[model samples]
Target chain A: MTKYLAVVSSKAEITALEEFAEQKLAKDDAIVLLSHPYAYGEQARLPGSVLKTSFDYLNREELVEIEGERFRLVPNWYKFDKEFEKSILYKGIQLGELPFGEVDVFFRENLRFLRGLSNAIRKENPDVVLTGKNSVAGSSVRAVAEKQQVKIIRYFELGKQRTFPLFPNLTTRKVSESKKKLSRILSELGRAKRGSKKTVFIASRGYLGNLEQELREKTGFNVFPLELFLLRQSINPLVAVKPFLNKKKLQGLFADAFNKYKQSTGFRENMVFDGVFIGDLFEFKLQQFALLNFPEFVSLVDRIDALFQKKKPCLLVVWSDFVPFEKICVLTAKKYRVPSIAIQHGIFPAPIYKKAGFIRAFAPLTADKTAVWGRAFKKILVDNGVEPGRIVVTGSPKLDSIYNRHFEPEKFKQQLGIGNKKLVVCATQPASSTNNPYQMVEQVLNVVERFPECFLVVKPHPVERTEKYEQLVQRANCNALVLQKTDLHALLNAASAVIIHSSTVGFEAILLERPVIILVRNQKRSGHTGKPRLF
Target chain B: MSSCLASVLQGKKLNELKKEMRKFSLERNICGDGKATERVIKFIENTAKKTGKIELKTK
Candidate 1:
């Protein structure tokens, strides 16, 4: 029986957790941590679990009821020793940790809430800890739990597939009973992509960064793709050997690699313990029975070789060098003597300033030639020991989309029903960076509230739906049109000004000739959070 | 120097800002010629020429 507690995100996850609790948890013997967005938290369906929250033992007056949501917000949530709080916040900053938006708001609630949760976990002293996400706030809680020597079980969902992996470390979490034909996976991606490529195999995780359309304009070749479930960090770890290849022979080849990986003494020597990916080498070593030697990589090599013989692409345009699949893509390309190129997808050349050398040191720069925005990005790659000849400055094609001039600003304004009002576009990125997008809208709403003639257009990041914000808008009683399924550039083109926390839209504003404000509310002093970074 | 100029120009009148922006654009050559993708394609094609065969027609 599992002795530890569980952290849940939503009501839907509550059902899954209840199932998990009933199946594995001891009766009347579990602690719970609910990182619920609303103030109400969960009360109805949770059995044999207790919420390890600030309110669990707090005075009722301390919790402020937030309107329009089932939850309350603690405005003065920094109930801990002030200096200790300061140091924890600074530790987050020193780690180059992204504080979703409003650092003060995030840290305060975390201090009040997670402190209670961590304390409860310490008191319970359970063997296993379960959670939904291992990002940001989850990262903080995991740090607290790691010291207690607790085993972690994470519940992850990829489309219709759900996985429960009791992990020893960050990586090595496998999806059981989920394996698809590599050909079928590739074909599904191609079908979803709908229009393009040169038999060129581009290993990507998310949307192809508009590269496929640009490649179509440049070259007529088909772009067959392979995207490992980068979101889950779980791929088909086993590759099926053909009818003839002796399994023992392949296993023999893998044993040496696995032993070398397992036997590595130093940080740089371990193949699996690379800084970019948090993987467990011990688990990898134990997988010899699953794959006949060389793990699934030998099979990847075989499948890719077959694909090359069939598709015959000129090169590979991989999406990100950060993901593990890029390593496989590069190795396969090297074997076939096919060129591999990685496009810098983000606004900035990665490795947040001080850690420029850290990216060079830790992350695997596997692409033969990195297609970057300009000389600056090319410089970063070359500094990182990538051959200077291999760095090509490919001015971002996504930015090139703005020049297409497809959407009329006036027409877009008319469509938004903001007739003659000066459009103040408030763009919010996905919740990964900012836990609450409502904060971004709140910031814009605050400023737009002052400007009587300004029409606020809340443009949400494509990944998360904005339907949830309708109620928040209704509560705030703000005249805001939360836009969905609209062209961002067209909206940006229409905007008299754009307000953002950290976002790439600032560059779009520059391209579209609009005023942009980067808001980082807290600075290195009195209030805690400082002026924000507008990318 | 560029950021300093932008910071100073932030709250200026629209016409004044536009004039300053026009001047800045003139001095810096910030305008695109719509040939970035073309240049990138050329670079890619040139790079691919080493290992892959391409059929280019005479213009």
Candidate 2:
């Protein structure tokens, strides 16, 4: 009998695996569904199958030392060096750590998943490894399988009815900017209505929460959303659309950027980080990214330069400095000698390892000052080597709405048709951070099943898909609501007890004076709460 | 379900569970008197004035 090890990351992948098995599996074949144990518990409904989870194989932690600084292997933080940062310059100014922000953070969170996956591949030694293509899990699985010399089959979902061996390469397809054009027009309209000589450029209006209105009414300065503001001030629609119109010109521009990067950094010849040949990693990431996205960067640089030339804002504010576009804005503002502030949008954890080079999203302040939620968050930043003077405890402007607005829980519960049952709110973390999101939902559903008095409402992270939660709830035949777009404060207010796996919602739930249960895989991973308090 | 969660939902008083949860201090004052938005505005006003960008409106 051939043994098969199937790896799944998202809930959608579960369905893909089911399809793969239906077409590929024989009756005598043995299968083991390897997942994050808590990620998808009973949802792996293949009968008579052995199951393994990411938690089962998280034994070893790998580190790559570069120039006496130890960095984690998963995020590939060796690329986050000063030399690499200096290479991607626009008009001789560094383009603000472009290649290593959002994606790196996700990798950092999935360190456990990667490590566990590598370990599982070694031990399971399955005859064939099946995985989805074009996912983090898929990429890691491919790397691990190649190293272990295991036969790997990548399953690709084509149309509604067809499963294919591989998906068509659509990278060379023409770029669509229709949505962006509409947004730019809308932004122009908004700016025309509220344009002023004395304007303070804020990040996205979405990040401003209720403060956007308050800033306009209370403060004398006109609040302008940064991208819209910049687009209106600079970037002619014709100029912006020109690069997309000429395919060859766009490719030529990308080639120029790539050649410049290689010449300046010597990355093509000897891009070694502390003895490891890391050139391929850069070739795949930084060089490839700069090549593919040169036009957008060029446009951004032009727009920013024009914004500074035509109209310089008194101050710039962003939700996070580490994010690519916001980082560019912050860096350019600094170059123009304009002050910028990055507000702390999410709660941060204390340093997990005592190592010197644990790359955190908040480290090495890019903005002149960082507006934090509280002293605790500020302390975390300071501990991470940020200057104390640059840290301000402004509290959370987003949380202000929860405190100020009156929420009637009883009426809201009635509206949801959950009549008088003890409401249990489970706010899930993203798949990267949590042990198993599927398992977490399953655990909550099990509790709701046991206690007839309790009703569950699963609130998935903004990044996560709610269909998985709905699927699990349906499978378990439980009375639970998987709400992705409901008012979080109302849900918390209506909840009799709040369950979380290290989310900012836990802090919110605590503030609302609700009973909270923090589900941690172990004590070591409980950096968000300092210590887990399970009551 | 784990016993801790099972116990939380298993006939325990909601007030008592809340009391226990509060015992584990989150170390920092999360939100202070719900005036965070006002403080953010005040910070912006101060920063803008210090930088000589825009004039603040006095209430």
Candidate maximizing DockQ? 2
A337 Cα displacement, candidate 2 (Å):
1.2
RMSD (CA, Å), each prediction: 14.3, 6.6
Instruction: Show how many residue pairs clash in every candidate, following the order shown.
Output: 22, 7
Error of 2 at A320 (Å): 1.3
State TM-scores per candidate: 0.53, 0.77
lDDT of 2 by residue, A364-383 (tens): 67899988887767776777
Name the top TM-score candidate: 2
Question: What is the C-alpha local distance difference test score of each model?
Answer: 0.50, 0.64
The reply for model 2, stretches above 4 Å from the true place, is: A7-28, A35-45, A60-87, A92-96, A109-114, A128-197, A204-208, A227-243, A246-294, A353-360, A431-434, A524-535, B2-6, B9-13, B20-26, B53-59
